[model samples]
Target: MVASLSGWLQLRHTSRQLHSRLAPFSTSHASPSPSSSSLPQSTPSPSQSQEKERGAFSKLLLFLPGAITFGLGTWQLFRRQEKIEMLDYRRQRLEMEPVTCTRNNMASSESLEFRRIVCEGDFDEKKSVFVGPRSRSISGVTENGYYVITPLIPRETAPDGVQTPVLVNRGWVPRGWRDKVVSGEEDLDKPSTSSVASNTGDEKTASWWNVWSKKPTSPKAKEIVVPPPVKVVGVIRGSEKPSMFVPPNDPDSGQWFFVDVPMIARACGLPENSIYAEEIEDEHTAGAKNPYPIPKDVNTLIRYSVMPQDHLNYTATWYTLSAAVTFMAVKRIKTKKVRL
Candidate 1:
């Protein structure tokens, strides 16, 4: 009985000792303190903290701009496409229409007509006018030049007796013919201070309107200068401007080659009331030199038969930019974050 009691006492003592040893470890795991529950705090030095803050600011600066730009660009892309499509549709509609100039006529049969009408007329070389000289953007250059204007006299007199052949802007000209010496009653050879003044019987093929004369003059479409008038098939568009300068007796080689109708009428001793048209294709006439001259069709241009492509392209770009800005603003609102 004594041995049994001793053994029992010894076992109890061992159990107590084991429990005492494990108490601290068990308490630490079971009931951690508030501070201990959180992650360890790592405080930077003052200098390090300032450097980190600057780094964060720099990142924000870089990231914000990029994010804004990306958002804006995406918005613009969609809007740009939409506007482009709309213009494309409008351009197509215009081309299908006929060219007509009526006062305040928006969608008239003659408003956007690219072609399909047969203008029965003949080139009035006598009244042919070299219209305003201007620039056309080819490639990236603003090429120096001008267009020749010649009103075609209707073969079949109009009900109102108006010639109505329309103004024809022949082509472009270099900036060399601005002086009176170059443009005289007659100077066939290249512009010169000392050269023979030969009065070539020709006028259209004359020294004036160098560009048009460069290539053979488009022949006057007429089997017999009577009956069967010349036919011009092309689009009817708007006019640029009128020349105001007096028609010099002989403009200088450096003088402008623009036959503004209102201006030219005053000079030609005729009434200012006139119409204008450009010929893309001309019918072959017996009186014409090189009877069948190849036609130059400008319809290949993107905005052909209607508005110009450059203007349309610029408009698209603007709309795209506007859309992009709006989109960026929307995105900024959505992604805005607050500092805690």
Candidate 2:
């Protein structure tokens, strides 16, 4: 009985050793517990979540500039279309025959802008305003000049026996000939007293009045002959709005840059809403020798200030940049996805 008991104990020990050897393999092959498998996967840390949100936000930021540029490009295209339409309208108006411009028909000046018109009037030479220094391209030569703005009184008087006049941009004159034009001189070839004095040094010789007061002699005023009542052919022009870069018109100082219809009318003692017109140069007189006041041609009057080609160029530039940015953004997104 003792031998049988000892043999049974040995068998029990051998079985315990085999069970321990198989325990590691069983654990390795076993499926996860239900509680462990179902537990929420280790939740992303606050830092990791914030990093993911930042990545999305950065991607959006990359598209913002492209979107803005794309919108600007579309706006430019619209502007280009508007410019084209405006130019077409102007061309149509210029093609039509000139209409008679009188007090009766001058009320629709806005519609008549850039349209040629004829008016019978006499110029008020005393109320001439010089606006300068404008630059002109004459026969491929750039010349600095001033525009002479004169008031024209109609042959017919108002009910109150007052002549309501219109403002006319007579034409452009050389910078040195402003006084000659103002003095109603047909010829600018004659040298002025100031020029003679400067050439001959006559200014150094002081007269009795000048020697005592130490002041320069004032030149005698030239007689201005009023032009007879005549017919003027011109295009109706609207009031000019000064750009931010343009300096304000100084009426007190008589320094005029751009044509401000209202301000110029007030300065010249005319009605605030006086009609403004730019004289069209006669084709016959275009080749006249040294024409003091050279009027602008029909083409110049109807030309667009900003060309449509400029807008087209801007549109192309913006669109190209937008496309490039979109391509790069998409590529970056794909790269990130591949890495993830």
Candidate 3:
């Protein structure tokens, strides 16, 4: 019995020594936790980790273009409505009948812009100015020329016979100096003021005034005087000041870029506060027979009809782009989610 106990003790001591050596290794390399062990082990896929890492910044990058497109689409819709209303208003105003413009009704003349009006006047051709580099498209043929602007003195006055003269745009004439002067297939010479017959004492007096002002007559210095004082039909107009893109008027050199009424009035030595008008037509045909044809107001159809009404199309295009972008973003997001 003692030998058996001794053998058992020796065996336990050997087992303890082996256990101590293994315990050091076990402490250094600890076993897994019970909770981790209880769960199924899975190797994380790279794609799933990448999807989880995606932040709000990545989502914003995808949707920003779509948001901008949608905003532009909404803006186009508003512009479309404004354009439609503007076109309608202009069309209605143009179709209305001609009204008589008098000194009594002059207060409301500003509102009469683009409206047809009648007035009795005598043209002060001495103060006429040639506004040039003007081009017109007639029957698909382009005619490059200069516009004659004359001051009209109204016969009727405010109790005092003195009147405020209005500037009148007296139609287009071919460029006199640059090219061969041709009007409707006929070669015409430069307009001569000397040939203009003066019937009235006022005309004779004006001729004297012209001689005095010019001092020495220059061959190039030509003045055109309308023979009769008569009823004039025209449209009241605002100043057509040149846009920023247009070259500035060189009045001293007589190079005109636009129908700047104030500048023309100043250049012509007319009253500075003169209002302007565009004559409907002259009694005589302009060319060899008459150098000046009365200015025709702008054609209503040509002025307003060409306005673009493609806002609806533009809106649709923007919306379509927005929808396409949104669809692509959504599709990509779904693909990512599925991969994850």
Q: Best candidate per lDDT, number?
A: 2
**Per-prediction TM-score:** 0.38, 0.71, 0.63
Superposed by TM-score, candidate 3 places the C-alpha of residue 295 at a distance from the truth, in angstroms, of: 3.7
Candidate 2 lDDT over residue span 99-141, tens digit each: 7765567666677788877766667767788898899987999
Compared with the true structure, all predictions reach lDDT values of 0.49, 0.77, 0.68
On a 0 to 100 scale, what is the lDDT of residue 66 in model 3? 98
TM-score of 1: 0.38
Distance (Å) between predicted and true CA of 203, model 3?
26
Candidate 3 lDDT, 157-186, residue by residue in tens: 333321457787767776653233322344
Residue 115 displacement (Å), model 3: 2.1
Backbone atom clashes (below 3 Å) for every candidate:
24, 0, 0
Off by over 4 Å in 3: 1-9, 31-55, 95-97, 155-163, 176-226, 241-243, 281-294, 305-308, 324-340
lDDT of 2 at 125: 68
Error of 3 at 152 (Å): 1.9
Worst 10 residues of 2 by lDDT: 189-198
RMSD of each: 16.0, 11.2, 10.0
